[model samples]
Target: MRKSLISATAIMLFAAVIQSCNRKAETPMVHPDFETSYWIDIDLAEHPVRGYWRQVESLDPEEVSDSAGIANASRLLAEQYGANKLYVVYHRQFELDDARRIFIHWKTEGERNGLEIVPTVVLECYSEPSAMNFSDSTICDFASWCVENVNADEFGIYDVYIRQDEGSPQDTQMGILREAIGDKLVRIGLQPGEDLNSYCRSGVEDTWTAECQGLDNELWANPDSVDGTDLYGRKLLASWVAERADSAQSRRIVWNMIPVAWDYDKPVDDRGYVCPGDDALINDPPILGRIAKCHECIVEGYTDGMLTEKFGGYSCDLHILQANSAGHPDSISFYRQLRNGEPYTGYFASAMNQVSDLYKEIATFKQAKSKK
Candidate 1:
């Protein structure tokens, strides 16, 4: 009887171990994408000095010199945006290899927000060429579903389509798009008979096509032409294209095109296109409007460089800078000044306040228990 009891106990322990392993396998650990890590590092760095010079003796020399302050500040910023907790949950519950499955999971999470328990979530996914075939109708179906389900008022989807093929013919490539998406195609920056390949070519420095040039001119002439409605229309089409092109099997090519729109009452001019400074356009024109406007903007690629420079200042609250990555160091310096309660005016001041308000809202959301 003692030997039988010992055998039974051993069997039970073995079964429990197997079950634990199976659970872990079912939910593989996840980690932040490469771009997320890069941005996090940038956020943790000391604010570079810019504009004014002031000399103040440190009361606690050790505290002043400690690098952890920067990291802590970054953590606080992430927490305010809910990105930190979002990433934590994502890392524990999902894996990156399965792009389609991950995207569906993200959309489902967004839907859960309708119940008012889950915070409205944006899922940004990176796909390899192997997992995508731009000619597949199934991918288009998936994109259409996502677009239909996306509650623009609450949930958002940011997908980064990575392509590997270097030099494919314009029509040939675009033909696949037309075939896959059918009537869903919404052309932007391209005129009838003009192929996307002719305008934007890979491996070329002067890659901007004639259509791109035309769009730039039109935007400069009339900022309202690229307003919110126009931008969102373009984004919806782009999302479909991205979904069709993204595959886990492809290699070497990646395209990130983010379309954004601004709604403002102030007049915009060429100066508005430049990064805000003392020399920036007068009245500051709110730079890019408010953070809420930015929330509505389509985020393409690894960052918002295109939207910030060519289009205008990005009102995206999550981004610390209004300009491209190149200007981040300078922007960080300005941000630090604003944080220290230094005097600011124009668009810069307005943007800072908007971010503050957004942070507060997220904090409130975090504290509230979900109905679910």
Candidate 2:
């Protein structure tokens, strides 16, 4: 009887171990926090608007067929992803005063998805043309002056692009520009020319030459090459601006300033889209890190009275999203639903839920650490 009992006990123990192993195998592994490290930098050239449209068409058939549809769809997608305003930067050939105002035509007017969406004008001002061969210090100083002297009430945000001159090192120029701007205002760096692969590629191969003349031309011609960094910066800045605008008792008024590549007379592409390649950058892990860094800077700058003195408290929510004009018709419809404030469905809904879960996990971790 004793021998039989021992064998039965061993068998039960073995079965328990096997069950434990199976349970472990069935459980999904928890991923590390996205904020832990910078992941891949987005390559815009790899994902174009046309490519997105193919996916969109599979999902929805009749959403985006013309320029108006494209514009409406873009705005809806932008808003659903947490964008407060849309802007198109106008860079002209002639040098305009820092205070000059050029009115671009209004975008498609109407209420879509029960939200009043009005597209605003974004004008670029150059202190000097590329021909002037301005030094780094000169450019920075001019940009600083332009930002400082601008009427905050009139303009929500200032999008300053320090033009890369011939023979100037892009990194050195950007560093100097940042230092010059200091905590007074935040500015983003843009790629200088048409060679998207030159700046977008990994390693030492990424280099930009100031061969491109006008900002508009460079952006329009090589929209694929435009760095995601710039778009991320713009999104970050816009979020803060939107938050401030929403506030009622706020003393300081912030405006949205965008650096755009504009061509008025140019007809819409065969795809019937305006600014075909000018989609907002995707907010992947690396881009999120960059956005966080920018947010930190803005917070510190505001606390130090570097950005403005009138506003006592300023905060922003960063929930930026990206969509391509070339996405499928279904994608366009999806955007419309999102813009209308409907609950996200399908993959987007699942993805957003995952993001929410991650945030909760991080919160729990922080709470536990605090108790310790």
Candidate 3:
């Protein structure tokens, strides 16, 4: 509560003092050059529970394989409006020379696509069965594989994400990564609203949260930064101080918003697009509006970076949690995308008409629980 009040006051004072003369407006306005430059990390898995990328393929076997749909989805993201880069994470989907085969294939596709594709290789899912670990040999072996076989020089793994879900920080993991794939950017991802407190060994539980410990890499959400029931104030930036901080990574806020899916148990097409459920976010206006507002704040925050020249020193990557069972493009129904259910199979049936008929079934029959 105090932090929220303080933040509100600080931001208010910043405007009052920082711009006493040019204060023609009452509220903050985005600059003319303001543009969203943050990378949108999109996860492919729907039900990425235990053996998501490593062991099992999908919730069903008859539909789209996890490995095949990524390329098309990557292309779609590249072609979309608010997204310029795809920070994709492919742990172990295809049959790898254990993993080497699929890693190369993913990179090749990324390179061919010609977008800002940051392929991150996970080296820290030690708890989950079949997931990668952080052992000396394991770490060294993966690092060596990247440098030697994977070729860290090409469109290689630029960023490496470590998922320590159990809240146990591998204190030595950073040093080893630095020594080996130091050229590659390394950051740790923590599950928001969970046992992040355990990550902080120091008893300063007030401000030093598990999110703040990322120092370099901050919140990496599979679904979102905070759950729908939870407020943003309750999690992020609650325990951050600009001055009394150790390093640039720890000094400020950094988040990676990867809005795709949390428990994705749906069917997918040839494209990486997942067939959204009736309870999917696209159906609820209130939640969908919230998601839009969250992205709006993220864009505003990133644009604010233009104010400071030296703020670059702070290793900040504020993730706008654009998550939750990746948006159903075919069912872009609520917003002018919904259309007629009748099939115009006569001479008038055209390509455009067929496109509109995509989600006609849902519009004609399906009713969301919230809507009812």
Cα-based lDDT at residue 15, candidate 2: 100
Where does the lowest 10-residue lDDT sum fall in candidate 3? 201-210
Model 2 residue 67 distance off true place after TM-score fit, in angstroms? 23
Best by the TM-score measure:
3
Residue-level lDDT tens digits of model 1 in 1-372? 999999999999999999987755543111111011101111212321110011111111111222333333334444332222121111101112233344444334323322111111112112221212223353344434434543222111111122212443323443454354343322112221222332222110111111121123334323332332332223433343333234333121212121112322232433233222222222222323333333332224213322222221111222223332223333334434323434333235454455445434434433332321
Model 3 TM-score is: 0.43
RMSD of candidates 1 onward, in order: 21.7, 18.4, 17.0
Query: In model 2, which regions exceed 4 Å deviation?
Result: 1-173, 183-321, 324-326, 332-338
In candidate 2, what are the lDDT values of residues 187-289, reduced to their tens digit? Answer: 1222222111121111001001111111233232233323322332233343443344344543332221111112223324421113323323311121112
Error of 3 at 68 (Å): 5.2
Where model 3 places Cα greater than 4 Å from the true spot, the runs are 1-46, 49-68, 93-98, 124-135, 147-169, 188-254, 258-292, 295-372
Per-candidate TM-scores read 0.28, 0.26, 0.43
Q: Would you list the rank order by TM-score, best first?
A: 3, 1, 2
Q: Evaluate residue 201 in candidate 1 and report its C-alpha lDDT on the 0 to 100 scale.
A: 23
Worst 10 residues of 1 by lDDT: 202-211
lDDT of 1 at 53: 14
Best by lDDT: 3
